[model samples]
Target: MSVDVITNTSPVIWLGRVLSGLAIAFLLLDAVMKLVPIQPVIDTMQALGFNSTTTLARGLGILLLGCTVLYAIPKTALVGALLLTGYLGGAIAIQLRAGNPLFSHILFGGYIGIFLWAGLLMRNNQARALLFP
Candidate 1:
């Protein structure tokens, strides 16, 4: 794309970066619950229906988050885009299941859109290099 087009997509770029952080924070929350093996953290995730599989959840969550963070960093942004985009997919699925048409749908949908845009932007040679490396 042209410089003008890329310049106008600043919001998308920012959203992608923020989403990377969010992914990290959320997964870290899960990771703390599982990897740390602390009762309190496990209790919390269990309360939220993340019981039994907390370890797997934690590992995947962290792996996904790490991917996004790496993507935000130079030379690894595309992988981050891949990770964040897929993570958002799972997020959208879970949020959709909650069945709150207003809050759940809008919030998750917006998040998905942002990540998708970021992923697409990251696909571009210019945007990818700028954001990732």
Candidate 2:
């Protein structure tokens, strides 16, 4: 059997896919790290005033992973995006409360959020219509 691939492609779509892939990969890695709760992660959590509790970290990790999965699936992507937006907003608030750097720490979440939304906008017509129209 022959495979039917997306043939009518454009640069914007390609960029969207790439951005979505990047966000997914990064979020996946982050979730895994939190689940693992390695030494570095624990330290970072303590630095961020999270009490560095393994249970809490893993719970948060699982939640983030769930959000990422939702964002990755086409049917549930809108809900996933909305969830991730809130998650990223919380991250930004944490960094701000921790007195982290403006650009490197606090704004990092905003940057990733931009990529997530922009990628969705470029590749998904439904998302585009919801956002623009």
Candidate 3:
């Protein structure tokens, strides 16, 4: 019988981990900032036509934190990624409605989504196989 071996030391795996880590870090930071309801965050939310209430910010932060946590877990990463994609899509819509710059603001969520999926595809054999097959 042949044993299937997975090597974590591969450079490609390392690159994938790095990319995923960066996305996680950024998302965590964003969640924390919203949880804190910092002045700048509140100001930005108001500018985006969202309710500037601290309660709303905290609620959003909690949702984001939960999603990010799921994404950080290997088993639930796909579900988390899907949730994040939905969240990002909403963000993109909001930015577009606010007439934000296309590249810098409107498409920012797409950029993050790319990194998220790319990292997952590279590191997870199951994901790659599922997609490619």
Best candidate, lDDT? 2
Each model's lDDT: 0.57, 0.88, 0.88
Mind sharing the TM-score for model 2? Answer: 0.91
Give the lDDT of residue 79 in candidate 2: 91
Among residues 3 or more apart in sequence or in different chains, the pairs in candidate 3 whose N, CA or C atoms overlap within 3 Å are: none
Ordering by lDDT = 2, 3, 1
Model 2, 27-127: lDDT tens digits are 99999999999999999999999877999889999999999999999888889999999999999999999999999999999999998997877777777
lDDT of 1 by residue, 21-133 (tens): 66556545654555656667566445445644656556765675476467656566656666666766765665555554656563764655465455546334565446655
Clashes of 2: 0
- Which should have the higher lDDT, number 1 or number 3? 3
Error of 1 at 131 (Å): 13
Model 1 per-residue lDDT at 28? 52
Question: Which is the better candidate, 1 or 2, if ranked by TM-score?
Answer: 2
Global local distance difference test of model 3: 0.88
